[model samples]
Target chain A: MDYLVTHSPALIVALPLLAAFAIPLISRLGPRVRAVLCLAVLGLVAALVAILAVDVHAVGIRLYTFGATAPEMALPGGYMVPVRIMFEVDGMSIFMGIVITTVAVASLIYSLQFLNGQTGQARFYSLMMLLYVGMMGLAFTGDMFNMFVFLEIASIAGTGLAAYRTNMADAVEGGFKYIVISAVSALMVLLAIGILYAQYNVLSIAALAHYMQYTTLDMMALGLLAGAFVMKLAGVPLHMWAPDTYTVAPAGTTPMILAASYTSMYALYRITFTLYGGHIDTAAIGWIVIIVGVLSMFVGVMMAVHQTDIKRMMAYHAISQGGYMLLGVGVGLAVIADPVALANYGRDAMNGGIFHIINHVFYKAMLFMTAEAIFFRVGTRDTNKMGGLARNMKWTAIFYAIGALAISGIPPFNGFASKLLIYQTVLSFNPVLSVIAMFVSLVTLASFAKVFYSAFTGPEMPGYKEVREVPKSMLIGMGILAACIILFGIFPGLIVDTIVAPATEALINQAPYINAVMGAAP
Target chain B: MSALSYEAYAVWVPIVWVAALVVIGVIVLAWRNRGQKSYKKGTAQTDIFLSGIKVPPEEQRHVKAENVYWGFFEALKGFYSVLMRPHTGVVNDYILWFVALVAVAILILVLGA
Candidate 1:
């Protein structure tokens, strides 16, 4: 058990990577075998992450040094800095790990039938595994350079998946746009890492955070890191690539991309809170985040209402929902200096943001799966062409309604719980921001209601008379997420107490992270 | 099972709201049922009505999805027009937006610092 706990971090990432390579070879056996292999591999990764989360909760941060005899050995010569690649499994990282693994498992199960009989099945599964590996590695790694490497891996694999359907010219175009944006963002991140390494002679995030002096170069590097991550996170004015990619990607793969986006959002929060906390102007950067978030919420949803394509509208909703996270965390960051506020409201705000990450994953994936089911049956992405599908696709309709309610922040669903936290906390910080968030939520409901009315309710359309419900395996995949949504919604306190609170603590407290990496501070 | 509590704000079980909804729904259902005659299928009473005139189902105009929010869109016509102008669906424009954002972020950070 101790061995499993000790090596879980490395195993969680490494096992999937090994399986990703092994998949193509296994593909020669049969497609069914390949599908089973993918599921088993992802299931194992999920179990490992669950174990790691439990271990991190039971003890504390789990710091594993690569090629070291001991996990916490920072320096061979007893030097005061970390020089080796380390996997730092804190509460926050483990929280993100659980989210990624859970969503990846569900997505892989969904793809079993969603992409059945399609050509290049083996390649699709392999790329999916690689994307999973990249997200897990990005979430778990403590080194900045390692993060950049993982980001590249995720981006490349994601681009391939987005362009998987080569029959569609738009798919190829979307992939091209994604790769261009990813390359530029990766360069910016790499430049930031280089500047940090040149200044501190270290690639370790915790080490640099401890030794950071907030110089001019450090500020520039911070901007670069923040901008690159924000771009990757699909923040508005910069979110133009998202709708195209989401619309073009295979249905089963969109959820994975959403997970990847959240991983980058996690990086953004990590950079702001853990890496640069107390060393920079929190209010200035917080306001910057808040502004970006505000714009994203307004612009993303407004554009969504105008979109006729169902997947594209959901894609815009993704950007808007991401804005809520940024806003919640930004409010917390903006008030970090006030101990009273930090204790009373800031922590709650951060909790809201982090909680929303998991909730959004479940509901958004469900929504995408529902959209896929609609597309599968109706053979169209346009809502105008899809009416009264509920008569045939009963399960799909129910799942879509659950997802629509959840995404719109309606009560008795996960989105409402998290958005409530964000609203209450941010309202105390600034009433106007809360008002904007509420307005956006209303618009979100209207947008999804548009989808519901067009795609599910009203009179049955002429062309879809022959359509039926999606396959059982697809329902099973969506059922998992729908169940999670209901559970998380009904037990918000449990989730907040168990997962979000510790993660929030881990993010705000940098001293323990630094000490874990560089040894206890003398 | 436990409720979400932050400071003085508490959201316990959703049962209360559910029960209230059930009760209100029952009342509404009962009220509508009071003194109402059951209409037979394919009768004049069952036909659709527009401005006090019955219209045949086949001939009735079904509201399109785009028309559901027509009033809202009409009210915000100017806003939607300007907001959507930049979403050109072109890769070059997307990159331009990204670079412009990065520049704005850098400027904010540098100047704020």
Candidate 2:
């Protein structure tokens, strides 16, 4: 037990990575053996993350160093600055861990049947495992260079998965676009990392935070990192690749890819709140984040409201949902310097923002799966070509309704719980932005309602008369997320008090993070 | 499972609200059950009437997704036009927008500092 707790972080990233490489070789045994192996590997990783979450919560931040005499020896005895790579499992990292593991396991279950009889099954499973490893590493890594390395691993694996259907032109095009966008943004992030390393002479995020002076060089690096992550996260003008990539991604992978985008959001927060906390211009940077978020919200929804393709519409809404997260956290960042305001509303705003990330992941992923379920059974993503699916695909319809209501912030769903937090706290900070957010919620509802009517409730279309409920594995996959939505909605306070509060505290307070790596100032 | 409150400014007790909605739903159902006893299914009473003209077929009766919000689309055409200008689906244009954002962010961070 002690050994497991001590080495869980490394195991979480390493286990999946090792299995990802071994999958192709394992496939020679048999498909059944390979499938069992994949599930067992993912299940073990999820268990490890849960254990890590508990340990981190009970013992504050936990750091495990690679190539050290001891796992906890971030700084060796004789060295002034630490030289080893490390995994920092703070509350925020564990929180993201919970999100990624839950989504990955469920998505894998969904894919079990969604990709049945497809060619290259072994390679598909391998790429999926690699994607999971990349996301886990991104959330846990303490070193900036490792973060970039993990980001590339995720982007490349995701590109391969996005183009998994090589026969389709759109699939290949989507993959091409994603790799192009990812390569450029990753290059920028690398440049920023280089700039920081040249000046600060450290790769550890904790060390950089301890030494960040907000010089012009630091500002330039910050700008590059911010741009790259925002683009990666699909925030507005940089979001063009998302609709295409998301719409063309194979079933089950769509939600996983979306989770990758949220990981990018996590990186953005890490850089802004942790890396350059005290010396930065809080109000200016805060408003900049807020503006990008607002634009993303408005433009994403407006575009979604007009999309004819079901997947494309959902992709736009994903961008819009991301904006809410940025808005809430940006408001918090803007007021971090003012103790009075920070105490009054900024903390809650951050809570709302951070809470929304998990909530959005669950509901958005389920919604995308439902869209894919429709495509799987009816052979069309065009809403115009669908009608009265509820008559046959009852489970899919119910799941879609749950996801739509939750995402639209209707009563008694998780989306309302998180959005309420944002609306109330943001109203205190800025009423106009709050109003715009509420309006966006309403627009989101209208858009989903249109899709529901066109796809599920209308007169039975001739083409879809034989459509049926998705496979049991797929239903089980969506059922997990839907259950989370309901549970979260019913117990919003419990979730916020336990999971979100620690993460919110972790992000807002930089001293604890820095002190964990470098002992508290003499 | 209890109420979620935010510093006394707002409270959301979803369980209570859901219960109330259920009760109201029961009352509405009771009220609905007490009316229209004379109406018969599969009779002339069920025939559709639109401005005293012939009703459209079931297929035509259902609205297509694209036409669901025609009025909103017409009213907001200008807003959408300006918004859609940047979404040209070109890779170069996408990169350009990202570059512009980086430049603007650097200026803000430097000047603001």
Candidate 3:
């Protein structure tokens, strides 16, 4: 047990992967036993995340290379390999892992009943576990190339989950589109990786960091990587697949996608600022991101406003909120040239960007799960057909309001804090973009207000007028997610200082991160 | 999250910068602008073209101002289509995608050598 604590990062990745494989074999066992085992795996991962988080806080950055190979020079001369596939735990990665694993726990609990009559329950749970494995792997791993592998793993699992219900044409179509778009992104990322490997022989982020000469090739590689990530993040122009996919996929799966969206974005942070080491001038690319972000915000929200389906609206808004995140990243780059401004804009802007990704995951999950409840009771997610759901599903209504308020960046919510920082950073960095972002936020607020007014308030429609509260499993998931949103809102500084701040620092402070992986030069 | 925190409460206080005061003053301006627009509408409202045969305009051709992107969406028709397809959404296709992806990884690994 003590040994496991020291190697908890492995447990974090392992328990889920093992469970995923183990579930199919256990199909012959009682359903209750298999379900308990799934819960236990989630519990173990959650415990591992908490333990690793505490350990990282104490140790600063807990590096556990895969296969227990120590970081060492593989051959004589300049050649060195990072020990194993390192599960490098800084505050940010651990925090993300905690959120991801915690959410998986909730979703699985929600799934037990959701998948009650659904055939292939074992397969579904297996895919869920696989997704968690990849998500944890994505968050914890320090290397860029390794990140891609994990992404592929997660994407495969996600695609499976998206198509879990093959009877629905929407699910099948949505899942296909999801896989194709994600594959295209992965290909672009691979080409970028190829370019990087040619420039720097080693694939380890630490090795790349040491070789941070910003040649045109390096810049081109970065461009490819960024383009790919934007697709994965479902940033503007590349976000066409999300609305359909979210609408069709099981509601339990939608939150994971939202979580995955930000995780990919975080991977980009690791790539650009960490591996490349702020060496490449990215003002041009950042400006492009800002424009895209602006477009995504207005465009995504506008499209969302026209949606009668509730899940689709949340999906589009996910894309829009994604814009807010990238806008922060863009502002960080555009304003971070001067040392004085760099400290303020670079660190603060990145903090806000990263924090918002985490914040969005919580609130968005709450909202999605609430939508799930609506669908469960009303047997539909059509806003035009729903009204006065608050009267019956009081807890759901409260949770949904919390999600809506938080997402809209209303005061005293999680979104408000992050958006405020992002807005402030943008305003100080470039007031013009800030002005555009402010209008975008206003549109977002207005759009969500429409959602609330249409679906929760307004005149009570007949068909779903007698809708009862959802099962206990569903409420539990929504409740935890809603609680997370409220906790993050008031005490953001606490989480930000520990998790977001450290992650931002890790991204920017390249020297230490590189050394931590590669060790000092002989 | 910045070291120099711009606490909203502090920034939003009454006794702030001149620009801040000017910005605060715009709420009233916007309010007044809305009021003026409403007043203009009050006088402007009349039967279209003074009781001429009033054919209701087609819903699609409504003359209200709409977003520019409403038109832009059609221009970027290719872009909009990207959101929709590759749609034979079989689980087997996903498996194929993964297998192809894995093959690419192996190819990259071998070719890199």
True contacts kept of 1: 0.43
Superposed on the true interface residues, model 3 gives a C-alpha RMSD in angstroms of 9.6
What does DockQ give for each predicted structure?
Answer: 0.44, 0.53, 0.07
Per-residue lDDT tens digits for candidate 2, residues A1-522, read 999999999999999999999999999998889889989999998889888898998899999999898898888887757679999989899999999999999899999989889899999999999999999999999999999999999999999999999999999999998999899999999999999999989999999998888899999999999999999999987899999999999878888899999999999999998998887878988998999899889999999999999999999999999999999999999999998888888888888999999999999999999999999999889998788889999999999999999999998899998999899889999999999999999999999999999999977877777787899999999999999999998888889888888998888888888888887334
lDDT against the true structure, per candidate, is 0.86, 0.91, 0.74
Choose 1 or 3, whichever is better by lDDT.
1
lDDT of candidate 1 over A146-264, digit per residue (tens): 99999999999999999999998989998888889999999999999999999999999999998898888888888888888888999988898999998888888999999999999
Against the true structure, whose DockQ is highest?
Answer: 2
Q: By summed lDDT, which 10 consecutive residues of candidate 2 chain B come out lowest?
A: B1-10
Q: What is the Å distance of residue A446 in model 3 from its true position?
A: 1.9
Q: For model 3, how does the per-residue alpha-carbon lDDT over B37-112 read when each residue is reduced to its tens digit?
A: 4334435463356367665543322221123224555675675466435323344544344445335433433344
Which candidate, 1 or 2, has the higher lDDT? 2
| Residue A300 lDDT, candidate 3, scale 0-100 | 87
Sorted on TM-score, best first, the list reads 2, 1, 3
Residues A1-522 of candidate 3: C-alpha lDDT, one tens digit per residue: 667666787778887899899998887796888899998889877887877777776677777766543422222344355434566667667768877876787788777776666788889889989888888899888777778899998888888988888998788888888888788778877887888889777777777777777676676666667666766777766677778777777878888877787778878777766776567555654676678788788778767755678898889899989888888877676655667877856678878888888888888887888888888788777776667777788888888888888888876678887998888877788898788878877777776777677667644455555788887877777777777787777677777887778777666666667776666554
Candidate 3 chain A weakest lDDT stretch, 10 residues = A68-77
User: What range of 10 consecutive residues in model 1 chain A has the weakest lDDT sum?
Assistant: A71-80
Q: What's model 2's TM-score?
A: 0.97
